[model samples]
Target: LNLVDLRLTGTIPPALGKLSQLRRLALHINALSGTLPPELSGLSQLEYINIYDNKISGTIPSELGALSQLKELGLDHNALSGSVPKELNKLNKLQLSACELGGT
Candidate 1:
């Protein structure tokens, strides 16, 4: 529940997926818009997720690969589109860095 860059707006409150021992969730550079709440893949002790520079759009939520202890996934900038959910490559401790979609 780090709530980084607290310019937060709205959306993303799917009850925080019931916080199943939530590990790290930094709402980066906020003004949070819509999409990206696949029940947060039920958390499952999420490792790190920084919703970078917000204005969130759609796609990229293939149930977040069910988290399986996600390493790092910061969706860079925003206005996300499609094509990125090959089940997140099964997360093998994913290191997606800054997932740039539209812009900053």
Candidate 2:
């Protein structure tokens, strides 16, 4: 589901992980807060996840590395903290942003 640029509010529901067939999820440019749901790692078929330009905080889940099919992960301009998970390096095709987790 592509929910980008919707100016959405609130946090991402962990229940979304139930979408086992999901290929792309874009929640960028919204007012959503809270950490990325580690449950999202359940999306084995996910190819892209764009949640940039939001108010979300917390660290990127290392479980996301389970997405062998993931190609891009955009988490820029958020309040996220911590270093990028080395497990993410396993994504050979991943195009990540703001994973450095410097001062927020």
Candidate 3:
């Protein structure tokens, strides 16, 4: 499926984590807010995930690093607070914004 430019609210459903064949997930510019479900890590085939400009608040889940194939992760301008997931260091392609992380 070709899904883009979707404005979804509430926590990201754990069900979405089941898309084993998903390649890209873009849900930017929305009111979606909550901790990222570790279940999302199941999407091993994901290459991109755009959930920027939202109300989502919580520590960046270390599980995100499981997207070994991920090329881009957009999570800027949100209420999220916490140390940047150290696991993220494993990603070869990451473009996180300042607002999502900072020195304590």
Top-TM-score structure, candidate number: 2
Off by over 4 Å in 3: 1-6, 98-100
In model 2, the clashing pairs are: none
Top-lDDT candidate index: 2
Candidate 2 structure quality by residue, lDDT tens digits, 1-104 = 98888889999999999999999998988899988999999998999888888998988898998888897887888888887887787654543354447432
Weakest 10 consecutive residues of candidate 3 by summed lDDT: 1-10
Better of 1 and 2 by TM-score: 2
**lDDT preference between candidates 1 and 2, better one:** 2
CA lDDT for candidate 1:
0.79
| Candidate 3 TM-score to native | 0.84
TM-score of each: 0.29, 0.88, 0.84
Count of clashes, each model? 0, 0, 0
Question: In candidate 2, which residue ranges exceed 4 Å CA deviation?
Answer: 92-104
lDDT of each: 0.79, 0.84, 0.78
The TM-score ranking, best first, is 2, 3, 1
